[model samples]
Target: MVFLAPKKNLFNLYFLRYKFIFLTIGLLFVYILLNGDIRSNINVRKCFSDINVQNKIEDILLSERKPRKGKTIFFHETSCNIPDTLNHVRLKARQACAIESAALTNPNLDIYVLFASPKILNNQTITPILESILSYPNVYLRNVNLWSYAADTPIYEWFKDGKLFKSKYIYSHVSDFLRYLTLWHWGGTYLDLDVVMMKTIENIPPNFAGAESIYHVAAGVLNFDWDGFGHEIADMCLRNFQTHFDGYDWGKNGPGVITRTLHEICKTKQIYLMTRSRCFNFNVFQNETFYAVPYTHWKYFFDSDYLERTLEMTKNSIAIHVWNRYSSDTPIIVGSNVAYGVIAEKFCPKVYKSSGKYF
Candidate 1:
């Protein structure tokens, strides 16, 4: 017993010799925990020789929240309903400009362009426009099938040509479904092929959708994360997509779903101010900063008289939706003094170069 007591005393004495060092380390850890500056003071030493203090400190710092590194990314995708006629849907220079504008404006984002069609892949043709988009390091093009996006859901087979009622807008409906699936599962920004980015997308919190008009939240620009209310909204929309789906109605799948979901989330049918964005879970923007020119005024993009006015309006907007459906048939004159020409020249010089004077 006497020998054991002496040995214990000897061990205590050994530890007491570095008591000041141990106390200093404890204080340092407390300071690090309190102060959010995790990037500083990485050379601190620990009293114990076996401890890898730096790695332990890193783990602790990362445990607070998901460590988000690098510039924020916006996810985008497009679907060609008639995959058999992929050549008709090959990426055009204007569409390429939409992607280029996104990458050029943000510079940090990795824009993902998912092509949702099986038949398109069978006979692949890379147009000059697609070649230009492929050159960007940050832009990625991928294949995403309908079953791949909504395979497990109830409305999985609804995408089949013969399964649903025939309509001219079936392709558009499928696009809406794909956007929901993409944002729900992947969780990032979704831009229409017609939209062009004008400014950096920053400061906005996650899980947000925007309204182009009163009670009309368009799915063209949807930004969300995989966590929190994003997944919930997606789940709600997908489930309802199974229940209240209509192939005959044009807006039923796109804007209609958004309006219905908004009502479900807010628990009201009253005309709420979209500008205020007082939803319970996430926010919805109606302010023109999100979409300067509404889809109805899409022709203004190609009109020479509205060129000066459009340019003035675009300064405040983060992006402009060109409403390709309305303006797709119109030719873009590179130097004939139009808003589209001016926008193309400034935002995407490469695309403009291809268009030249008469395209």
Candidate 2:
């Protein structure tokens, strides 16, 4: 007797036919979810300079015309070995204060603090210190990873082809590179975790960077729009980074990258660097207004003299980078005489009160 084939429902028929294909897809989905985007692998090496993050900001400078209204950004690169441990609590809190201060002073601006890893955001309960920062109405948080910071831009593939940070160099260099890429992707201010806003940044230009000295432009406080100098400068800087890199010199990738790129850009512009008032596609802020505290004396921010000399500097300064490199282990005591303690109480009173530690 011949047996007849059973009629099957459409769903069952399709499922039987595509079972192997569906299994393969399901496995891939699980792999991606468990491992994250392949583009994010740190070793997926790319030269810092040559990677194309996005457009050259200079070409779009004035042509870009205007920036999206109200934008400021901060990057917290915890992945580069910077953990939120007790030893680092005050410094992290101070960084949070800087962001909150900016948000409070400039209510019109949309301030963002991008955490490089989900470690902090993933925590079920963030430390009380972080509470002060999260309380701000204007401050917002984003979870960015290695891939998100530089991926899907003009140079995502190029970067993935080459190695990024070196094992020998301090991981902060990784942060330095990410800041440049993030700024290139989205033109806006990029603040180091060390900064503290003293006043409203109402004067920040559409495409602008601040100078730490006549020869060096500090990347600590930088801003730009996608179509303007921000992109142009970052693109050129990344290229220079590929050609001239010194892992031993920490600044080589940070301030040095921008300073070296400025020379190349200025040469093309054929404008004299005299008077230090040189104009580019966007704008350049001078040292007097930007670098109120020179690198040599960054430690003063933790001393008592800050009440006098430091405040004097802020007269023309937009913010201060307390140089936490020298003070990461330092604590900000309540009702203490330290400069950082004073600044903390003034800018992040809530955090200071939450500390509940007399020491």
Q: Stretches of candidate 1 above 4 Å error? A: 1-89, 119-126, 153-167, 270-277, 356-359
Per-model TM against the reference: 0.70, 0.70
lDDT by residue (tens digit), candidate 1, 155-191: 5665443333233464576567777776666666777
C-alpha RMSD of candidate 2: 15.5
Model 1, CA-based lDDT: 0.63
Residue 271, model 1: lDDT of 31
